[model samples]
Target: MSAEHLDDIGARLAAARARVAAAEHDAHRAPGSARLLLATKTVPLDGVRSALLADAAARAGDPAAPAPVLVGENRVQELVAKAPHLADLAPEVHLIGPLQSNKVNQALGVAGCVETVDSVALAERLATRCAASGRVLDVLVQVNVSGEETKHGAHPDAAVRTALDVAALDGLRLRGFMTVGARSSDPARVRAGYRLLREIRDEVRDSGEPGAEGAIELSMGMSGDLELAVAEGATIVRVGSAVFGARPL
Candidate 1:
């Protein structure tokens, strides 16, 4: 990448971080409470590397910057392909897309966490794979709060039950709940969906069930709705275009 391109990536990352920090403050949440997860869906390897380098440079220059950088991939193939190349940067990678049962082994090979485990069957598959490999994988229950047929997640009503079942799995650690907010022009509608996820998260945490103790994170929102998500108690926001300047067509 050219120096100008690298500078552009750095600027975009800095802007995204600022947006996250500002959102946290506006919501009266502690600084750095809501972490940003760079969604590298179609980004090329150089672009991803540039973003990581920029993030690292920003944190090194400012000790008070938000927490360490996190990168999320929407495809197992992408994760498998890029993770090895980016291993030297030590980016905390999470599989944020729908994972197939057959691909569990490959997904676990690279992703340290799976954020879209939406079903007990899928959770079981992950657990079986983890058991054989002796690896404990972090997971979040993806809830379709919007009831969007196109979205991949457990229905909002079944989220708690799904979370409980996932928690019982031996090789998985229930980290929290994740949801893609309702796609609507009304911010209230979007915020309502995020708030519901938080409510479900609280219910699970309050249940005192085994493995529910650590299920406190709420990963919601994207570049557009991050403020709403943060206001609704999101601990992590997955951002793409806002940081990467739109994916390639």
Candidate 2:
């Protein structure tokens, strides 16, 4: 990336972080309660590094800045392709897209977390892979709160049960829930979807089942509806276009 391009990315990243901070305040949550995860889909490796550098610079300048921004990719192939190059940065990479059963082993080799475990079968595959590798993988159950046919996640009605089952697997650690939110023009409708996710998370955490105590994260919200998500108690917001600009068509 050219110096100008890098500068633009840095500026955009700063703006995105500011938005998250403002949303957290508006929601009456602690200043840094909601974390930002950079969704790096279709972004080149250089651009990814630039964003990470920008976050590092922010932390170096302010003691209270959040830890290195988390990185998430929407494809196993992308995660496999970019992870090796980003290994030196020690980024916390997450597989945020659908995971094919055949690719579970490949995903385990790269991603530190899998945020799209939508089915018990998929979770079982991941567990078997992790056990063979002798490593426990952190994961979040993806809930289809919007009931969208296009989305891939556990149905809203079955999310809690799926989460509990995933938690029981030996090689996986349930870290709460994740959702894409409802796609709509009406803010209330969108916020309702996010709110439902929070309710499910709360229910799971209070269930007192083995391994349920640690399921506290709510990875909802994105560039467009981050504020609404924060208002609904999101613990992590995934931002992409607002930070990296629109991907090439």
The TM-scores of all predictions, comma-separated, are 0.97, 0.98
lDDT of candidate 2 at residue 195, scale 0 to 100: 95
Q: Across residues 1-249, which tens digit of lDDT does each residue of candidate 1 receive?
A: 466776698898888888888888888889999988999999889989999998888889776778987999999999999998998999999999999887888898899889999999999999998998898999999999999899989988899999999998999999999989998999999999999999999999889899999999999999998999999999999999987786768
Off by over 4 Å in 2: none
**Per-residue alpha-carbon lDDT of model 2 for 129-246, expressed as tens digits?**
8898789999999999998899889998999999999999998999999999888999999999999999999999999999899999999999999999999999889999998888
Q: How close is candidate 1 to the true structure, as a TM-score?
A: 0.97
Question: Poorest 10 consecutive residues of model 1 by lDDT?
Answer: 1-10
Looking at model 1, the pairs that clash are none
Q: Clashing pairs in model 2? A: none
RMSD of candidate 1 to the truth, in angstroms, is 1.1
